[model samples]
Target chain A: MVSRRGFLQGGAIGVAGSAIGATSGSLVANALNNTAAETATAKRQLPFYGKHQMGIETPIQAVTNLVAFDLKPETDRSSMLRWMTLLTDDIARLSRGEPVLADPAPELAIGPAGFSAYVGLGKSMFIKLGMESDIPAGFIDLPAFKMDQLEEKFSGGDVVIHVAADDPIALSHATRSLVRDSIPFASVRWTQSGFAHTPGVVKSGVTHRNLMGQIDGTANPQLNSDDFASVVWMDQGPEWAVGGTQMVFRRIAMQLDTWDQLGTKSKEEVIGRKLASGAPLTGTLETDAPDFAARLPNGLSVIPDFAHIRRAAPEAFKERIFRRPFSYEAGISESGSVDVGLLWCSYQANIEEQFLPIQRRLEEFDLLNKWTVPVGSATFFIPKGPEPDSVIAQALFS
Target chain B: MKKIAVLLASVLLLAGCAPAGQVEISDAWVKSGEMSVEGGMTAVYGTITNNTDKEVTFVGGETAIAGLVEVHEMAMIDGEMKMQRIEGGLVIPAGESAVLEPGGNHLMLMQLTGDLMAGDMISVKFDFEGADSITLDSVMAKPAEGGDESYHETEMDMSN
Candidate 1:
């Protein structure tokens, strides 16, 4: 199959190269001289999470939903450095468009800053390097995962790698691979892809959802171009991360069956925007600029006193998120219904800065909050780049 | 039965022979251009001519820029002037020139690459079935904020 990416590339750059050779390589070379996507190398080692990987694990519903890993507590400073390298490598490899690269390092993955330990041993300082070893297992929360099968074709054939390593380093290595490959990925992080639910999001099979369903991210940016950049990518980070963006993968399952049971007006209120274009209640069309000061036909605030979009954008922080999501369906058995929901993904700078505040406010009312709930969740940091750097590659056991 | 069959065949033939058309974007670049940051989705208007001998229909074209591109027919909707993406492509008759001007059947270049002050050409390819496929360089003009295409008639002649 002539891949959509390949087809588009045929129109976007294919014509250029053929035309370039016909004329002179000077023009083509000069145009690509500065582009990150045009100049980056093909493949590189994922710095972190190498030794811990048991290979890409797929979920039952034909969805490679869980990108899980094996991890242990950090022993010393040397272990920390090794873990950091793996973390950075994951980010590097991913940005380049060839994530599932074999050969990730063990000593370099995430066990040093693993958050699971916090849930188990309480606040112990010395046991298992401050990690809570007793916490239950988790995995990524997308339904209908298919390992090695490129799912969907919304933006051509962009892959979403859902990963959860024990430590930040491993997660980082996994993330880097996503970034380097330019493969659009989201990490909820705590759960393994294709694995059973981590006891939280059980109602997934009946309705579409996420951790906080209310149909989260009704106000996402368009993927027409890098329009997502302004809303998602952050500036002023580690120079390596300067060009990168942050991706927030939340497993929010909407209680659609329940949402359908709500009053029509009440349901509309949960999502501040309209069901059609996602425009503010005061307007229409997804791209419509909201008139915050305007009143409805009945004299009420067009966006209402408590709406998600208004709080999310707020004329002030003007913070927005670019969402590239897909629907997942995990079939437990041939007869039983499948676990279906959204692979809720968003990109932005500081998750705490932009996404959390909006979510916190929505969690307050969001009318749809009744049915929606957050289950297995993890936050993986994604760097911006079309390629990995030399500093990030490392051996699996290094 | 024979008469009905003849009538049906005639209708089917008419539908199939509907005019085929194409659009070409020449010397394209974004107007009101500004490089780097803080640029709005500009308007892309150009002259689209139905070059076929038969009266061709200029259907809709899609852009990678906006979430969705519509064939907008600007008119007063509910008291406020509004433009909507026509369900189908713009019907430009064969041998006639349909200038996709601002305030009319113009392309609303939403979610543009940047402030097009320095001349940015949005790559848009329009396919006209059997006739031909022409790619246009849509010039970006931010007629207004959000996604409205009603503008004070200003014509920037972008002729090939």
Candidate 2:
């Protein structure tokens, strides 16, 4: 494993320092002298720092969802146990910010990411069983979950756990415990790194890259912005969890064969945002909301009703979830078939009340629904990770 | 005689050293690999060269881009990859190049200065050991894939 110290690069620090500096925009003028002449700066700073030590200053967090059902549930219990053990160990390492276990090793590995630390929670049977109906059809291993269906539905999950913390060591300890416990699981997904911010403040929008080359996630929600993070990140989390938020990871893959055929315009319309720039159809920028009621030259909604953006964010500030997701490229077959899609994720205090409504609405009508499929789906309720106390779900579920 | 010899040796070492304009930077911008032209706050990308023989310890740097710009390191703990700040700014070895690549090591530019045009470049000076300063450059490239051509071609260059 590459030691965290070894991966240290001065450039990263340089940028981080600058980010912290920029956030003090209001304070900057005050440092020297805030003149009554220069209109006193407005609303100091956005309270949404995420749930980590860095907050908006934190580099984009990459998440990968690896979901492989114990399809038969009867396929060699011993093998499943061993697989879970390996996965458990891997999760421990990942939570701590270590790389995936490999020979030569990928250039980038996983670590606790920051000093914020994290929590890894293993779901109890009750949550899993209850997931049967309310969960998306995809997680049930249905057609929508298949690489062909691309309906972006949930598939049943065999195991689920959430690992997150600002401090690498904290994440490590939690992950190690899971491994020692001999949990059964598989990593069917991974979150790539990137950030989406309000138009002028940060890199705005989800013009993220999919393995297939076309900018993916054009239609996904764009949270993590100051306004949203502050409003969306609930303060009910424990004190150590301050500056940190909650997270949900879903392993959803897209149908490369069919999606590659759609024109860029078709893809954009399906997502409700521009494919090239990620801007909302109705708004000038990606971070801006699409003027759903705004009419086009032909007198139609600028962003169509079935568009993902509209479905995902119906009421402006009424319902919002902080989203930091990644597009993955795994399970590619030689026969022109592939499993490449998003490691769908979001951060919120209440999943049932806050997140599900948007997801259900999307499932009902998103036009892009025809292009992406959710194969291996699992819901991991992550708490603001930090403090050596205990895992997040432990307190909530146990 | 020993004292004289020591003094002479010290003088030689100091004399041979050429002044490296306290690590200066010309162009600096912050963005992730997945940056866009139309995006208001464009992800910034840039390069920082030590330009000196002595190791340059990074204290911290700042910019007007976002509400704050932090030096973030992208690390892969186990399976989850996360970005964070190194307590003491990283150490830049003498006579070498340290790159801020996408998804790995980068400048988390927050509140931006202006609408980012694809070709536009921003400026930010770096503060290093002592009053040591380095003016570097942040070049806006095509939205990257976490790694660049130079990154893949010379994997062995990382003496680390």
Prediction-by-prediction clash tally: 102, 104
Which residue runs of candidate 2 sit more than 4 Å off their true CA positions?
A: A1-58, A62-207, A211-247, A388-398, B1-160
Query: iRMSD per model?
Result: 21.3, 20.5
| Candidate 2 DockQ vs. native | 0.01
What is the alpha-carbon lDDT for the whole of candidate 2? 0.45
lDDT of 2 by residue, A1-398 (tens): 75676556555786888888887875876665644412221111222123342222233333322222322333233333333333323343343344433212323443344312233222322244342222221111222322333222343334444333333343344343433222223332222222222222334343445554444444334444666555445455445334344445565567668878888777777777776566787666645646778888898887888887778874544456665555655566888586666666565555556666677777777777677665544444333432222223222322
* Cα lDDT of model 1 by residue, A17-116, tens digit: 8877867776666667645422231121223322112111111111223332222332332342333333443333332222322222323432222111
Give me candidate 2's TM-score against the actual structure.
0.42
How many backbone collisions does model 2 have? Answer: 104
